[model samples]
Target: MVIEWLTLMVPADWHERFIAADTAIWTHFLAQQPGYVGKQIWRNPAKPDELTLLIHWQSRQQWKAIAPTALAAVEQEFRQNLGRSFDIIAANEYQPLADGSISSQRPMAD
Candidate 1:
């Protein structure tokens, strides 16, 4: 399985709106995509402005195969719904290892 991890920074005042729009837009869209397993949104009280999304897919190829245009459309809709842009603090992809641990391989520098 492949896990797509995304961390975004959103204002505290916008948390409720952000979660609503995200669930309404992203979760609904992702549910229709092939190889989409599930998703979870998380928050930490110490860092209320940060939201973490864990998107599960059957395989990395299936997730990456999603069309760029489709992704762009969804993103545009999300921004429009929120009436603002969000900052993605970090993005990473991980795969589950045989030992029941998740591992992310970083790209080598040139």
Candidate 2:
């Protein structure tokens, strides 16, 4: 499996809206994709302005296969409709342990 990790800076006032839009993108858009497994969002307790997102996919190949054009469209819609709520501070992708399916233990937990 593959995981997409993102750290973002979001204003406290926009937190709820930001999460809602982010959730919509994952549930309505990414979830419809061929390799999408699930996604998780988190807020930093010490830093209210900070947020994190983790998105899981069946494979890096299928995850990367998502067309940039389609992704751009979804992002554009998010910005146009929800307005800018956060700025991504960091983003990365990784493949799970080669040993076995460890993530299968807890599919999508807090």
Candidate 3:
């Protein structure tokens, strides 16, 4: 399985709004994507703007095949609806460990 990780930083003052937006994205947007196994969102207390997303996929090829269409829809949500509220960082795709543990031992692509 492959996991797609995305980190987003939103203005501290817009935290509530961003959270609500993420709810919509996850439920309305991501839930409909093909090969989407599951996802989790994390909040960083130390850095109010920090948001982390972990998305599970059946395979890299499946993700790649549907990403263009899936991301375009998401991009519209970010740019048209929530653009002014946050800064988006790039996403990282990693090959999960055989044991299904997200430990430091998980190999990251170079």
Candidate 4:
């Protein structure tokens, strides 16, 4: 699996609005795309303005296969829905190591 990590800055007061619009726009659009597995949104109490998004994909190729034009359109829709632009603090991609830690039978939590 490939994981897309994005850290964004959205004012605390706009957290709810951001989540609502993101779920309605980006999440929905991603779900319809090939290789999309799932996504999660997270926040830290100490960093109320920061939002972290974890997007899972079946493979790096599949994730990168999304056309630039399609991505631009979705981003435009997202901005329009939120009525503002968000700052992306960081973005990164990760893939599971060859070691079987992730895929092993051992549970991550008891």
**TM-score for all models, in order of appearance:** 0.86, 0.82, 0.72, 0.88
By TM-score rank, best first, the candidates go: 4, 1, 2, 3
Better of 1 and 2 by lDDT: 1
Q: Which has the better lDDT: candidate 1, or candidate 3?
A: 1
What would the per-residue lDDT of candidate 1 be over residues 1-110, giving only the tens digit for each residue? 99999999987888899989999999999999999999998997999999999999999999999999999999999999988899999999999875433455555699
lDDT of each: 0.93, 0.84, 0.75, 0.93
lDDT (0-100) at residue 97 of candidate 1? Answer: 76
lDDT of 3 by residue, 1-110 (tens): 89998888866777777767777775467667678788887878997778888888898887788667667768677656766645668689988666655673657799
RMSD of each: 8.2, 5.9, 6.6, 3.8
Q: Model 3 misses residue 57 by how many Å?
A: 0.8
Over 4 Å off, model 4:
98-110
TM-score of decoy 4: 0.88
> Which portions of model 1 show Cα errors greater than 4 Å?
98-110
- Pitting candidate 3 against candidate 4, the one with the higher lDDT is 4
Using TM-score as the measure, which candidate wins? Answer: 4
RMSD of 2: 5.9
Give lDDT tens digits, candidate 4, residues 1-110: 99999999989999999999999999999999999999999998899999999999999999999999999999999999888899999999988776555666676696
